[model samples]
Target: MHLVIVTAFDYPDGGPVAARHLALTAGLAQEGHRVSFVMLHQARPPAGARSNPAITWTSIARAGSTSPLAWRLTALRRLDRSIGSAAATGAVDAVLAAVRDPLLLEATLRAARRRGIPVLHELLEYPDVVRPPGPLGRVQEQVFVRRHLPAFDGVLVISGALEEYAARSGVARTALLGSIVDTALETPLDPLKLTTTFTVGYAGSLVQEKDGVLTLLRAAAAAAARLAPRYELRLEILGDTRPAAGLTATRESHRLGLDGRATFHGLVPHDQVRGILARCHLLALPRPVSRQASGGFPTKLGEYLATARPVLTTAVGEIPRHLRDGETCLMVAPNDEGALARALVGAASSYDAAREVGRRGRGLIDASFSAPVQARKVVGLVESLRGARP
Candidate 1:
C-alpha cells in the first residue's frame, strides 16, 4: 500500500514525537509499503545523518515567515495542492494526518475528502487538555473533536483514552496504537556502565501542569531528607526546564533544598537521550492525572522501559493497563508526593528487584509494544480501512 503521513512538526528533530513517527515510517516501509512523511513545518535534516530512502520526507509549509496568519493561509493553500497532487499522481492510497492545529486538520480533511482519499486523523492528545488551560483549548475541541473528527474515514489514537474520546464523538473506526519505540535502538546498558551517582532521570518538559515534574521534585527532596546519611538521591532532568505556571523546575529544586542533587540539562538531541538514560539507575515520569493525561500516553515510557531501567510513574491515563505496579514499574498515585517519595525509597531499597522489574518491562515491550509490533498493527489498520472501500 502507498501511504502519506502528514504531521505538524519538523522532522529529524530529536524528540518522542519524531521518534514515534520515524519508527512507524520505517516499520511501514519494512512491511513493503511505500510511505511518504509530509511535514507541516519545515526543518533541516540533522547534520551528518542521511535520509531514510524508504521513507520520502517532504514539507508543505515554507519557513521564516514573520506573520502567523499569512503563513497559515499559505500552508493551507499548499496542503490542498499537495493532497491533490498526491491523488492526481495516483501515488497514495490513503492519507494519515497528525496535527495539533485544528485549522490544519480541517484543511487536510477537506483536501483529502475532495481527492477521494481515505483519511485517518491520528489523535495524540485531546485539545481540551492543555497547559494554562482556557477557552482556546475548548474552542479547539469544538472545532476538531466535536465537529471535524467524525468526518474522517478513520481515526488513529495514541492511547485507549483517546479511543474512548473518539468513540464518544461518534467516530466508529478508531485504532488505539499507543506510543511506540525502537527497542533495538534502546537496550539496557551493562551494569558496569552505570553512572557514579544514584541518578533518577526524567526526560521531557518540566511543565508542572503537564508532567508533574514539580511533584517529582518534592518527592525527591522528601526521599532525600528521609534517606539522608544512607543514600543521596541525585536527579538528572533532561529536556526543557523553562518556567511554566510562574516557576521553573530549577526554582522548585532550590525551594525544596535540592540544590546540588537536582541537575537540569535543558533540551538535548534525541539521539543523546538514551545515552543519558543509560547513566541513570532509574527513570521517573510522575505525571498527574488530568484531561490532558487522560487522553494520551507519554512516548518516553516506551523508551524508558526499552532501556531496562526501573521507572517510577503515576497510575494515570492508560499507564495502569500497560504497566503493572511492582511488576514492570514502581507506581504511585498522581499528585501524591508522599506516595511518590515512598516509591522512590522503595526503588532505592530494592535495587536488584527493581532491576528485575525493569527487565520484565523490556520483555513486555518485546511481546507487545516494540516498533515492529506497532508497525504491523498500523499496517493492519490501514488494510482494514482499504478493504472497507467498495
Candidate 2:
C-alpha cells in the first residue's frame, strides 16, 4: 500500500501529529507499505526517519502558508511546486489526510478522488469549531463533516473520546484509532529511582489555556518551595510557548521567581524526549484546557508511559479511563497546586514501588500503544470505514 498523510503542523515538532504519523506510517511501511507525508508547511521530517526504509516526505507549504494575501499566494505557489511534478502526478495507492485543516483535507481528497482512489480522513482534532463559516466555512458542518467523514475509505479516530464526539456529530464510519507511541523513540526505561532530586517534567508545547503551562509553572514554583528539602524538587519544563499570544505567562513565571528553579529547555527534538524522561522522576502535565481537562487522551501521556516514566496528570477527561491511575500513571486534579504538590511527593515517596509501576505502565503500553499495534488497528479501522458507509 502507498499512503499519503496530510498535517497542518510543521514536521519533526514531535507533537501528537508527528508522533502518531511517524509510528503508524513507519509501522505500516515496515509491514510492507510505502508511505509519504504531505505537510501543510515544509516541516522537514525528523533526522532519523526510517520506520519502513521506504518512507519519504514532500512539503506542501511552510508556517507562513496561512499568512495574509502576499504569503498565501506564495504558499499556493509553493504548494504547486511541491506537488507539481511529484504529488500532483505521483502515483499512490491510497491518499490519507489525518488533520484538522479542512481546506487541505478537501483539496487533497478532491484531487485523490479524481484519480478514483481511496481517501481516508484520519480525524486528529475534532472539526475546527473556533473558525466560523464564511470564506471556506462555506463547507457547512454537515457538508464538511458529512462530505469528509463518510467519503473516506476509513476514518482514524484518535481516541474513543474523540470517536464519541465524531459519532455525536454524525461521523458514522469512525473507529477508535486511539494513538500510537514510537517505542523506538520512547523505549521504556528504569523509572528514575532516587531518594533525592525528584524532577517533574512537562515535555511538550507551552500553550497557556490548553496545555496548562501556567498551572504547571505555578505548581512547580509552589512545589519547588514546598517539596524542596524533602524531595530536592525541580521542574524541567521541556518545551516552548506562544510568546506572540502575549508573554503574560512567561512574565508570570518570571514574576513568580521560577526563572532558576524551573528550566525551560525550549523545544527539544523528538529523539531527545526519552533521554530527558530518564532524568525525570515523573512526567507532569496538568492541562486545564477544556479538551485536555475534559478527557481526551493527550498524546504526551502515551509517550510518558512508553518511556516507563511514571506520569502525573490531571484527573479530567477520558484520561482517567484510558490511562490507569496509580497503576499506569498517577493523576492529580486539573490545576490543583496543592493536590499536584502532594502527588509529586507521593510519587516520590512511593518511588520504590513507583519504579515497578512505571515499568508496568510502559509494559501496558508495549502491550497496547506500540507502533505495530496501532498501525494494524488503524488499517483495520480504515478498512472498516470502507465497509460501513452510511
| TM-score between candidate 1 and the true structure | 0.91
Tens-digit lDDT track for model 1 on 1-390?
A: 778877776555646677788767766776677777666666444344345555666666666763667666777878887776666655677798877677888888888777678888777787556412577767777777667888877887888877887888888787777767666666666662233346799998877878888899999989887776667789988867554632577887898888888888887777777677777899999999788888778988888888888889999998998889989988889999999999888888778889988888888888887777887877777678777876
Clashing residue pair totals per candidate (backbone < 3 A): 0, 6
lDDT of 2 by residue, 1-390 (tens): 566665555556646776777778767876676777766655456566544457876655555445635433444445434433345545665667654455555666666666665666665555553335676654555566766676666567666666776676565565565658767656677545587688887877677677787887777777777666776777777776546422666677799897766777776887676676677887887877485445356777787778777777877766777676778778777767778777777777778777777778888788887887877776666565445544
Q: List where candidate 2 sits over 4 angstroms from the true fold.
A: 43-52, 59-93, 99-101, 129-143, 241-246, 292-295, 385-390
Clashing pairs in 2: 11-43, 41-61, 42-61, 294-317, 295-317, 295-318
lDDT of each: 0.77, 0.67
Error of 1 at 232 (Å): 2.2
Of candidate 1, the 10-residue stretch with the lowest lDDT total is 43-52
Clashes of 2: 6
